[model samples]
Target: METGAEVSGQAGLAPYPVVEEVSSLLNRPADEIDASVSLGERADFSTRVSELNAKSAAGDPAAFYGQQLLLSRIYGLVTQLPEGPTAEGSIVVQEVLRQLEQATIAAEDGMLESGILDAAPAEPTAFLSWLKKLAKEHRVYKHPYYREFIRDQATADDLRHYVIQESVVDGRFDDLLAMMQVGTSGAAKMEIAENFWDEMGNGDPSQVHTHLFNQIYEVFDISPDELERSLTANALLSGNLAVLLCRYRNLYAEAVGFLGMTEWLAPDRFVQVVHAWDRLGLPDIGIVYHKLHITVDSRHAAGWFHNVVVPAAESERMRRAIARGTLWRLNSSARYLDERMPELASHR
Candidate 1:
């Protein structure tokens, strides 16, 4: 079976009159024939889609750029396609989705490297200074997030296998219920629907699933094992700031200041835990970071900003405070990483 890329490329492979013959069959103008066949200088949009999907599965920034541009053009084409809701349009949509899955998978895998969470602790006052520097960066970053969404490598090789995992909680409960209605047991269906409803209702964080909740603390530690497993095994992992930054490098530096600061400072208390564990002469005993970045500093920093900054931010003074807070966040992350992964400084 020819992939979309193959079909798209051959769309223009024949002579102009031959191409006109194909266009006439579809009731499209000759210009449409040329443009669709050309698919742009970098091969047709479909080829770019295939390439972008492949690259994104590996967390490459360039793939993100190309994919975004390709999607924009294809979305326009999708609207104007002669068979808007037929097999042809569905094929293109499926191909686009295949590529998106690849990119998202790559990003999740990239997060698994120890470096993403690697950081060393700094002295209190010095850490404060670091935050000041980073906040300055976040204030000016501007990359929009909602553009060019897709699922690249969803199934093993099947293109139309629902590449991205859809959350039934996103106002799609009835649709899912319809699927379960076919011939499944009423008891099982009701049980699943109730669980879904519970997720949608989120009354308290602690009451959430334990496995779901504890992983929050693991990322603040030195082990990337959980992240590694997640990247390799799952395709519907929740999105985070770091993954978003990797995809949108244009906003990478600025956008991460706030999250970086929170990650850097949120686990301060955890640092104290390391110290206490050491003082008590306890064994390393699952202690990922002894005197370092693993702990509650990032949590505290996140709390302080969310609780203090968002509620009180109104005037120039508040704006300055927010800036100060974000800088402290970003600078601290860089400092922590600089100490933990000095090799990265060359990139800086």
Candidate 2:
């Protein structure tokens, strides 16, 4: 399969001023732009940068990022689009698909790290600009499944809780740290905690996650790259881990027993994800939580048990709120997968 790059590696890409236009349009600092370039690629990048500058002077502001990101997404869809019935076009389609896959992943990753995913609880001020960019792209180009995902999965409503939480952390980081404490030996008030591990524990939660991912992919017609770009999933898992840790740190300071005792007993839920991926032959795209948590979560969970739970949770009400939130997050994440899976599968 000949990708766009492969088809026009020498000639087509030569005139593309994406580098200059992107840097100037985004108003990115030279340092940031330089950070993205490889050591040996400076010369080529310099040439592209000059072209981008020239184009920027002539093109519409909304068109550049919108078109580029849209194109990036199309590059992904090109890979995932089913080869039509004709055999003659299959090779070309296949090549295009590969390019799309690479481009989508790169663009999505770039968006994620750039606080693009952090745009939830979106301000209309910020979102209007962003929407125009996306709208222009959709009008001028196709981005396969990512366009729909942005429209459907990432509505203003979906961002409410995340935005609230972001505000809490941003405004109260020092206060939260002050609330940390030691743990004690007392058991949890709810009987649910006694058997909670078993009830919620599906042996390996990664298996469940993998199943959910597969269900989502087949049902939603989501491409592998788009699935990888689902930063909402990343935030959910991160929020849970932080809450768990905050509680633990409070508990540990109070001399309450920490969860480290039980940490080893519970199954390695994330590791099982690697197993599931291998078994299913799924790409590593959707395994963001699995990859991040397999190691970092252990320390985080332990810290939470030792510090936040023991010290701050002075009443059953406080404990209840924390536990309820944990339960709600789990339930919501699961339900989202269940509901979306069937809908997505229909697209297949």
Candidate 3:
């Protein structure tokens, strides 16, 4: 719950000289530099750096940005090493330089974003309203790709591909819920745990959402092994990566935004998808997952928006992060559907 500053405290870990240089280069204050590099005391510096590296390797946009910032700071330090610093510099300095080189290479290979730190913030209400408008206007249910699939334009193989890809994505639901639970307290923690409980069926084996979803796949003859082995689509992968970036970075407002939009939009989106399954004459057992989301997600969405996003997003940066998370979800889904639409038409 604490900001990186609050958890790590202002004392003790003074900014390294290179970090200060980076701060000056970026026109940011020393404290901001410290926070950027500190990333809070929740994990050691190396471990956090490693995690960021992994996310960058996986193509997470935010993580890529963070990696750039981190590497720039380290590079600044490398530049400050003693003039005698040849390839034969102190082992410590050499190792730092080695890491800096690797990170720079990675950044060059990965997606690049400029001025991320300078992104203008927005008021929470305006940001949330923008997200709602975006969602309403670009609703996945309204997408032609989905409509075509629902209209029986897609072959059984196409439908099976979709089901498998989605089931693989759904398998991450519990993990996402658990990740969002971190750094929360009191009512927030309680609500999140309740959501987790609902997801896991309050510890009852039969009612678990994942199990219910698995049953739906079974009706399609998509064996659990098949679902597990399915390749993740890029859009789904990016969307999940965005959520994980927010969680790992402890970006609380972004996490709230991501979760809130997901809950709010699930029912609206799933309603059509579920109807499509029925139109295809799939068994009722295979449709419960969609039915369950339509019934439960509205309440979850409202609760999250009022209790979490509204209360937590007090700053422009936080609000902007929230907006980014929401848009990331919407846009990614849109892209996913668009890419798959042609497959259905081609099948026809």
User: What are the per-model C-alpha RMSD values against the true structure?
Assistant: 22.4, 19.2, 15.1
Clashes of 1: 38
Task: Give the candidate number with the greatest lDDT.
Answer: 3
Write the residue-wise lDDT of candidate 2 on 79-167 in tens digits.
23334322222332233323323432233233322443333223333332342343233211222122343223444333222222222
Q: Which candidate gets the maximum TM-score versus the true structure?
A: 3
Descending-lDDT candidate ranking: 3, 1, 2
lDDT of 3 by residue, 1-348 (tens): 101221011122222333233334333333444445543331344445555566656755444444443343333332224333232222332343345346533443243235432343355555556667767876453666655454456555666777776753464566567776887887778777878888897798888888888886677787745543343333334434434444454556566766777788777667767767777787788778779888778888877776667655566667666766665566556656765665553443
> Candidate 1: misplaced stretches above 4 Å?
1-43, 54-62, 65-89, 106-188, 196-348
Stretches of candidate 2 exceeding 4 Å from the true structure: 1-268, 280-292, 340-348
What are the TM-scores, per candidate, against the unseen true structure? Answer: 0.24, 0.25, 0.61
lDDT of 3 at 242: 39
Per TM-score, what order, best first?
3, 2, 1
Q: How far is candidate 1 from the true structure (C-alpha RMSD, Å)?
A: 22.4
Per-model lDDT? 0.33, 0.33, 0.56
